[model samples]
Target: DAGITQSPRYKITETGRQVTLMCHQTWSHSYMFWYRQDLGHGLRLIYYSAAADITDKGEVPDGYVVSRSKTENFPLTLESATRSQTSVYFCASSIVISYNEQFFGPGTRLTVL
Candidate 1:
């Protein structure tokens, strides 16, 4: 039984291109989150969803979009990929908002050249 999974593990794209990272969890977690990790920024929240059709922007939402059509899946899309967007993206899920431990996927490493 898989706890969480991320697609494409690694991607290389050009500037101005569009890229989507897929994330799925086997657990029926109530809260899902997207985060990007960089050298200086560390880990920054990009988006989050509380439930199906209930989504919200996180600390760093620009240049990215997210949607949760199901309780177990949350996808993140980069509208127009940029070199600065190159980072490690992670997806996490939790049973509740800040009260429970979060389960994170392996991660997707994206490089925009």
Candidate 2:
């Protein structure tokens, strides 16, 4: 059984373009998160959802958007892709909000030129 997965393991987009990263998990976890990892900034949360249709902004959410319509899938979209947004993106899921281990997917490396 596949635990978690991400689409387009690598992507390249030009500035001003729109890009969407897809994430899916076999487990029906209640909490899902989107994070971006960069050289200087480390891993920063972009957005997260507690349950289906219940979403909230995270630490850095300026250029990114996320939606969770189903328990197994969460997708992140870049409204207007920018060079500054180039980073490795990861998707994670947890059974609960606290005191639970999160299972992460293979990251998607996005390069905005």
Candidate 3:
């Protein structure tokens, strides 16, 4: 997609299972990000990739992993899903590192049983 696309728009999984959420964009944007919104409230950054193979931890990255093998794709994985990990995961892209208007995907709502 030219803008952004996320898989599993809605999901339900049991606790301790490994789940990977995919995000892809065609803009070749410089920055990509993953955030989780709980109860449709605050969006907390989980991980971000500046470019291919260049990723860093964000505010809530303990249970998440992200990788960018190409400039247009960034995927987020949860090593072991926990109850607290259930939330609406959003993928965003930006042209810069600063406060540029971030473009967000529809989002993936994950539930932990």
After superposition, candidate 1 runs with Cα above 4 Å error: none
lDDT of 1 by residue, 45-84 (tens): 9999999999999999999998888898899999999999
In model 1, residue pairs whose N, Cα or C atoms come closer than 3 Å (at least 3 residues apart or on different chains), thus clashing, are: none
Task: Give candidate 1's error at residue 16 in angstroms.
Answer: 0.8
lDDT values for all models: 0.95, 0.95, 0.92
**Mind giving the per-residue lDDT tens digits that candidate 3 earns over 1-113?**
36899998999999999999999988889999999998656999999988899999999999888888899899999989999998999999999989788999999999999
Task: Give per-residue CA lDDT, model 2, range 1-113, as digits (tens).
Answer: 89999998999999999899999999999999999999988889999999999999999999888889899999999989999999999999999989999999999999999
| lDDT of model 2, residue 70 | 91
Give the residue spans of candidate 2 off by over 4 A.
Answer: none
Clashing pairs in 2: none
Winner on TM-score (2 vs 3): 2
Could you tell me which residue pairs clash in candidate 3? none
- In candidate 2, where is summed lDDT lowest over 10 consecutive residues? 63-72
TM-score versus the correct structure, for each prediction:
0.97, 0.97, 0.94
